[model samples]
Target: MQQQTSNQATRRGPLAGVKVLEFAGIGPGPFCGMLLADMGAEVILLERAGGTFASQLFGGGRKAVANRGKQSLCIDLKHPDSKALVNRLIGQVDVLIEGYRPGVMERLGFGPADCLAVNPRLVYGRMTGWGQHGPLAQRAGHDANYAAISGALDTGRRHGGAPWAPPTLVGDMGGGGLLLAWGIACALFEAQRSGQGQVIDAAMCEGAALLAHGLFNLNAIGAWDGRCALDTSAPFYDVYPCADGEWLTVCPLEPQFYAAFVERLGLAGDPDFAGQQYDTARWPAQKARLTELFGTRERAYWLEVFADTDDCVWPVLSMDEAPQHPHNRARDSFVEVAGIVQPAPAPKLSRTPGQVQGEPPLQGEHSRAQLLALGLSPAEVDGLAAAGVIRCAG
Candidate 1:
């Protein structure tokens, strides 16, 4: 891969010279691509000739934040010529990411075996909900199903009621995309030393289980009951509503922090509140007192009261409000590109800063250009386009 310098001082990121091929898919795959692209990798997104419906919805026509910093190529994998073109590009790519149920890539002839044959140093990343092999692997499943099997969903339920869907964050982003990205990075690091590549099977179930490692340890130590409400320590972590009905999250786990929290809440003078911070027998009463005190003031008032204190209190900001928060704004955590508001590149590097290069491409936007860049002649590119193997964007 060739290193390309960006015009701005802050645009040349750590992964500037890396070349990645993203087999365009929904959810986790695009997210992983976005992460890599944010860090300055040259990512080429390979879409099918007709384009998947997901591409139309999420891959904003020249404006998708997730699709930023990537070029698109449309090809029919079923065609031998298209496969040959992909194989040729594979030889030049450092990493390949795909999110498909077990055998889909194999059927398309772009499986790890075929990719590694083309480039021995290619890091092939596979992301799926149930994984590559299992009784449920071939079965239809989504983020919820995978989290359910991994024991994460059960932990989110209150007391004995039905499990609450804790959004798709746990399964899709944390488990699927982040895990696959980590695996690819690790594999790339190892490939540098070994001079060979390997396949990364990043299953959502496995990643979800990994996320619950701390809880699992607590369970093993008899310090935790999976029952949500029964765990007195959990009340401290719960979100409470204020007088205005807005929510505030309070989490003061340390003894000193708890004492400070009690002091800040005017509960320090109560004898009943003393030495009851960790006592399960007193949690219900403590929680009740806290709730009652919290109800006396609006969320904004309480936020002001705890502004300079160590009570570990914070207002629960909504998604739209989060980007505008003082802290987020100060950190430059969000950016607006092409009229779309989204999160900025994360994990800041002092010397090499990341950036969102450009908007997502329209379907098959770079098919001809990418093929020509790969050293294919115009006649050959025209022949492939005529045979319905490749489509170029106008």
Candidate 2:
């Protein structure tokens, strides 16, 4: 039988011919699958039986991230049919993704060795917080925990309070999930040359450390003191609140940009601000002065003042405000799917840009259809559903 493709009649985008099987878990695995599906790979989510994902039909009232352009197949891996089914799938798919702790998939009989035994060329991508062989590998950890242990958390301390947490973007999506996708892509490329596949041990801790690569400059440059405003604490690289209760962020790091920023803000004549731009002793006072100045005007007023120049000052927009902005609209940075606005596929390709194929699938929504494409008869599909080994959406 021909290998199963996307639920749609024909796949689209740069990865049109690739096939992936994603073991349903949560977090980073789904995100990696999302990237593959976005690029037009045929990604099928292997959900466990008895799960009710459609309860989140609206997916928390917005588009579910990392689940677009894929089909969800509810499979009871404990059932006899499951072994046959997964073995068949492993033979056809180009990659397999799972975000479980190291031993879970091995216990399920779909570990890297198990899958590679079935398909020598299948890339096995695993995403985890610590990794497959570390001391904390089996320990439960969320994004923030991993980021904290990786030393990224300390670098982002918000004044005297806790470090600013961006939900799961840093550790889960950026470090774990995005790195898993990159690992899979790299593995696939290497497979082309060697005709063999391997396991990718993508851990959030490692990825988080990599994400904070720039922080190494603190140690490399001995004179730079973060508390003295040489880094994020810098007066020029701060966010300020405006009169209208909105906010603006500035990052005039370069001398030229600082000049433009100082001139534009009418602070060029102020002795405390002019030649003292980089004086560590003056940063606190200058920050206070700019804070007061920015508080005097609305965000829109300051936006217009530096709109034509690269003074590095702009509104600090929220999620809803971002897509509505002119620059985002011009770049098509976000797209609408199922009447919900969400970010679009990024780092667009020149010839075959990725796109949002569809909304997140209902659990077992494509069970019957995918089974049929896998060469199962209608009666066989029904029998499996009747046995509670599978679910086909009514």
Candidate 3:
């Protein structure tokens, strides 16, 4: 286990020795980079000159939260000088992550073939909505569109109603970014044994479908017809509105937990409630009874009722309230960087703890410094800058 870092530490992090280069893009690419950086990897973000719209979302200058913990290099890939510089960098990096349509990197002359040719040990990660060679590989897509095709969106809504649009959590973060990160980590581990690297094709559709594995298994077992039926299994497993109209969640599914939950609500002694524990025929009535009881109290009252108990009940906190919640405060789940409050690095290790080294850089903020670190001379850096191959924030 790695030692955890105190909030006061300001030097190297656990992933300090790892080097990664990220091609600037939206959704999963930046997210994956952020995850690596949070874990202490030295992430360098390569952006195109004249600024990309994606760069602006994270404060193009050295001030964005998403871009935090990374150095930035701006380059004009079409220029021969820029191409050479990038190739040189690729030769030295351990991992390379990109999110672009298939063939785009090849068109830019930095595809996996070219990148691996320069460095066979480079773990190349590619993120896309479809995949590297699927029939829909060339098509454009967003979070919703990808989820729709993956059967994830289909399993989200209630049975009789139209399919509901799930929060971007499933397709973007879960399927897209997390899958890319997992693939990169696996490839890196394999590289240790094989002394070689490989390309990781992380597609959102496939990842989203993978996330629905349990549901698929249930369907196969004939225990589930679709999304809604399973979602309404128990009064404690769903959301209920309080007297103040705010929602609270309960998930006491285990028999013991369910018994405690019912007892706390003053419904434990009823034989009807006891007999209907697993009765699908009694769901409607059970739901109505629970709803009526919950509706009689305010959210705060319910919170007090479940306080210090294992009833598995909690209020649905708003975004602003979440960080201030007791558990989050105790765990330091959020951090302030450059005046921006955002989530902290997760799955903390006892040793090799992660840290946010610095805020995101402006476009090309570290072009000169990074190039210099790569062994380029001052004159060479200037020449490339003059040739319009690279830009420096200073």
Candidate 4:
């Protein structure tokens, strides 16, 4: 198939000239690759041949929007000649991101020792749940497991129960993928000056702990008890149900904001809530009163009441509502691509803002063109395809 990659260099992002080779994986790995691609990096996804790529019901020839803005080239890594092909690609790319278990990449001959041998300036990024080394480095774990071990899950638990959150956001995307991406960017910048490549051992467990840095100090002083951190226990920081069955969240943490909130609710002069806003002893009564009061009105009423004010209150919008909300609309926080609505590229740069360069690709969609650009003869490419060493899509 004729490719559309010739014009990719025209994008105006900081990483416009960068090249990334993303070894196919799920969750954090793909998300990291997507971030790099969205920032105008030329990312080539090296997908495995004849494998079901399942992550959240997306598998068996169905590509996800999360994988957008990248080119896909399917290759059999177990093939004897695959190392040669990978080494060639390694020599060309500046960054390589892989999210496998601790030693999987080394076992497949794409480890730091192997790739850095081919390209001395290559930045090797490794994403894993437990990181590269530790007691549980090779243990089977997921996002929730990482959060649990990192002590993130222990803080802010409900009074009588230890509820576990889903494994998607905090661990996989935040700690696992996004942390790895940032480390790669830092290494890329340093590589320019040092002319050396380094390995990024990003463990979700450590990343999760890192995310709770401020909370650690709070815990140290005994000021932030685990239960007190829960929004439900605080009058000023909790989500309340509305009369219309919708939800709205409030977070007037500062004294000034809390005073404004209380005044607006017509409870400013009440003895029970007047000057003891920070008293943990009065929190339960205040929270109960606020809950009862907020439930008397619909979300629309509260939104209108708090409009044009810094009450620190807003509706708890779902995915469908968020894109159309006034703030999001004014900021253009979401965009439509290939008929699918999703979040836009973030943290705009003044001179070289990133963009969604293209839609997600079908597996092996650019294999022939990629191989040809790598100086492989058409006959040689065809022979490799015929021998099942590589996969190409028409």
Q: What does candidate 2 score in Cα RMSD to the true structure?
A: 3.9
At residue 262, candidate 1 shows an lDDT of 78
Provide the lowest-lDDT 10-residue window in model 1. 1-10
Which ranges of candidate 2 are over 4 A from the true structure?
A: 1-7, 50-63, 159-161, 227-230
> For model 2, what is the alpha-carbon lDDT of residue 108?
86
Q: What C-alpha lDDT does candidate 2 achieve relative to the native structure?
A: 0.83
Model 1: CA > 4 A from native: 1-11, 56-59, 159-161, 226-233
Q: Write down the TM-score of every candidate.
A: 0.92, 0.94, 0.92, 0.94
- Judge candidate 4 at residue 193 and give its lDDT: 100
Q: Provide the overall lDDT of each model, using Cα atoms, as 2-decimal numbers.
A: 0.81, 0.83, 0.82, 0.82
Collision count for each candidate, in order: 0, 0, 11, 0
**Mind giving the per-residue lDDT tens digits that candidate 4 earns over 188-287?**
9999999999999999888888887776877788866634534256778887899999998899888788888888889999877966677878887887
With candidate 3 superimposed using the best TM-score fit, by how many Å does residue 177's alpha carbon deviate from the native?
1.3
> Ten consecutive residues with minimal summed lDDT in candidate 2?
1-10
Q: Clashing pairs in model 4?
A: none
